[model samples]
Target: MTLWRLEWLRLVRTRRLVAILGAYLFFGLTGPLTARYLDRILGGIGTEGVRVQLPAPTPADGIAQFTGNASQIGLLVVVLVAASALAFDARREMAVFLRTRVRGAAAVILPAYLVSAAAAVSALTLGTLAAWYETAVLLGGLPVARLLVGLACGALFLAFAVAVTALAAAITRGVAATAGAALAALLALAVADGLTGVPWLPTRLAGAMETLVRGEPATGLPAGAALTAALTAGALAAAVAVSDRREL
Candidate 1:
């Protein structure tokens, strides 16, 4: 608890948290709203007098836009921000003194995990609320079950992001290298999903959000959840193993 508090305080004091949260909030609030007004925006573009007739946007359209924006751009931002947190600390040797004095991997691992989890929870909660409100206002009434399922999917997606970022940070001692590796890993998974047609991978979990929102049984949800759990375990084990071999 004490170590977690210390790490939490460090995270709170960093500008990265504020900046990332602010940007995410903006996107979360605007994603569905923008989707609702897509026709208007496109028509206003007035490209070469080409009149494009767009159909009226539906609830599913709004959800699709929200999921697209959140899963792609939003998740990328999350990975970068989370990777920077620990990567920066490692690069600056910020944990050296603590590592030497604490004499246990738990002191470092627990706090880092707690901080990452807290950030994920906050972002997921805010994004879910914004998505729900936007859907309600723009698309009229939405089912509570669908909303809950979407939220669950979002939470799981955030967990996958945290796990990936932590593993990247643990593997690389430099901030830039860690961030690059994490982003590359994420991008690779996305590319693989596109190429291989596997929706059950950890990286493609966010793509299942729409299914949940439609009250459909999400086929990829359980498989993605299992993948995330396995990845998280692997990341933690790798971190502990690496920490044990390090000189601190």
Candidate 2:
């Protein structure tokens, strides 16, 4: 517990973490608000006597916007922020020092994992609250179940992100390489989602909010969640193995 508290404080003192939270908050507040007024914003564009008619927005529309932005831009920001959390410490030999002092693999790994999880949770919770408030105001009151669904999805996605970032840090020695690797993984998933109809793809997991709000079971969501959990566990194991092999 003492070790975990120290790690948490170290992470909190970093400027990058604060920037990540700010960026996510901005996107979260804007997602639903932008969706609600999207039609009006598009309609305002008038040129050469051309007009486009859009149907009135619904609660689902707002949620869709929130999901889309959160999944796209929000995920990118998180990846960048978390990449350094894992890689930077390792690159600077901080991980090695901590491991030497702590004198156990679990002591070092557990604290790092706790810090990452705490940061991810804090950012996601704030973003969720921002989305909920914006959505409720734009499209009346939202259901509690739908909110829970979103929260769950966010947590699952963040777990996947943390795992991948840790893996990148373990595999690479430089922060730049780690960041690039993490971003590339995210891009590949996005590309696969755009090109293939695979149900369990990571990119599609973000959009699962639709099924939750509609009170319908999403066939792919559960599978995606399971796969994500497996992958996360694998990454954590690999990171631990690598840390164990390194000498301070």
Candidate 3:
């Protein structure tokens, strides 16, 4: 069987695929519901004397809720899943077996990275559609063009994230360390993006959905998206190089 098939089978046997999809889908289905009923939900909380009021939910609010949740905890699930798949050295025997059979580092690594990336994007797409449908039903209709654009931007970020996880897996000793390192790297990037206010930072893609829904001009998104693609390619190559040098 091909390495791609093996990587897919690894995800399936480990149930990481289900975890990834289920977490995103949960956020997608619930985010709109939460937005639509937030006022009512909050009405019962806190105290009997206090009250809170919120504006009527909009399509942007629904999508924002979904993206916000999906980008945080949902992204965590993707990172953990990808790191688990790419940290082949966690299983020393299997790593040795695969490395000996493969022609090169790329042959051993590319399939796993691509498979993880494909799975991550698929889960994100599923969640995006779920959010769109629920928001349309409960809040309001959204423009398909804008949603598609946002989804494309989001997918590019997911690719970059998986690439980062791949490189982390090459450097770390085990799945847990790989996940922690990748998450730290991602968090650092997010913090840097927020502090610098750089229009071209890839972390801006995290808000692309909300921005598109809010009718904001996406002039900076193309640059961020392009940089994300370039970084993804660079990270993947770096992962292969790092893995090539490591002892199996």
Candidate 4:
């Protein structure tokens, strides 16, 4: 509890918590609003009096936009922001301080991760609800239960991302390198998902948000979620082990 509280303070002092939450809220609002007005906005941009025939936007369209924003930009934000959690401390002689302590890597890593995850999940939840409200008012009402499932799946991906960033920061000294390593790993997962439709891979959850929103039982997601959880745990464990090996 002490360590977790300390990490939370760090997040607050660093202003990362505020920034992440603000960005998530902005993106969330943008998703449905854009979906609702995209045609009107685009039509005004095109040649004057040249009517553009666009398919009617629906709740699905708004949700799809939200999913895309969260998966792409939101995923990147999680990696970039969390990448510095450990990297910045590496140069501060924290390694020596931690080495003298009784707590192992999990003790240190979990708090940082949970703080970031909590902020991310909270923002995502708030944002998604805002989007849902907008879509319900502008486009149409969405299936609440299924939307929640999709949000849960998306949050898992984010949790994995925070773990990966921690692992990268543990291995690398530079922020850019840490971010690169984490993003590269995510890209590999995405590529694997696109190239091969494996049922057991966690990447399925990343892409499964839309499927869940569509009310389709993600046949692969159950196994994929289990896989993602294992991988996140593995990443945190590896980070602890690696950080322990670092010279103070």
Q: In order, what lDDT does every prediction score? A: 0.70, 0.72, 0.90, 0.79
Candidate number with greatest TM-score = 3
Error of 1 at 66 (Å): 2.2
Q: Ten consecutive residues with minimal summed lDDT in candidate 1?
A: 84-93
Q: What ranges in model 4 sit over 4 Å off?
A: none
Query: What TM-score against the true fold does each predicted structure earn?
Result: 0.89, 0.87, 0.98, 0.91
Q: Model 2, range 185-229, lDDT digits (tens) per residue?
A: 877877888888787876566677755775666778778888878
Per-residue alpha-carbon lDDT of model 3 for 1-248, expressed as tens digits?
A: 98989998998989988998898888889999999999989998858988879999998999999999988998899999998888988998989988899877899778888888998899999999999999999999998899999999999998899899999998888999999999999999999988988877888998798899899999789889989999999999999998999986
| Residue-level lDDT for 206 in candidate 1 | 73
Tens digits of lDDT, candidate 4, 1-248:
48778778878898877777777777778888898888888888999888777888878888888877877887777677787665644555765565467466666677777888888788777778877888888889888878888888878878888888888988888778999999998899888877887766776776565787777777977777888999999998898888777765
Query: How many residue pairs clash in all the candidates, one count each?
Result: 0, 0, 0, 0
Ranking by lDDT: 3, 4, 2, 1
Candidate rank order under TM-score: 3, 4, 1, 2
Candidate 2: where are CA atoms >4 Å away? Answer: 45-48, 88-90, 104-106, 214-216
The number of the candidate with the highest lDDT is 3
Poorest lDDT segment (10 consecutive residues) of candidate 4: 86-95
Model 4: lDDT to the true structure: 0.79
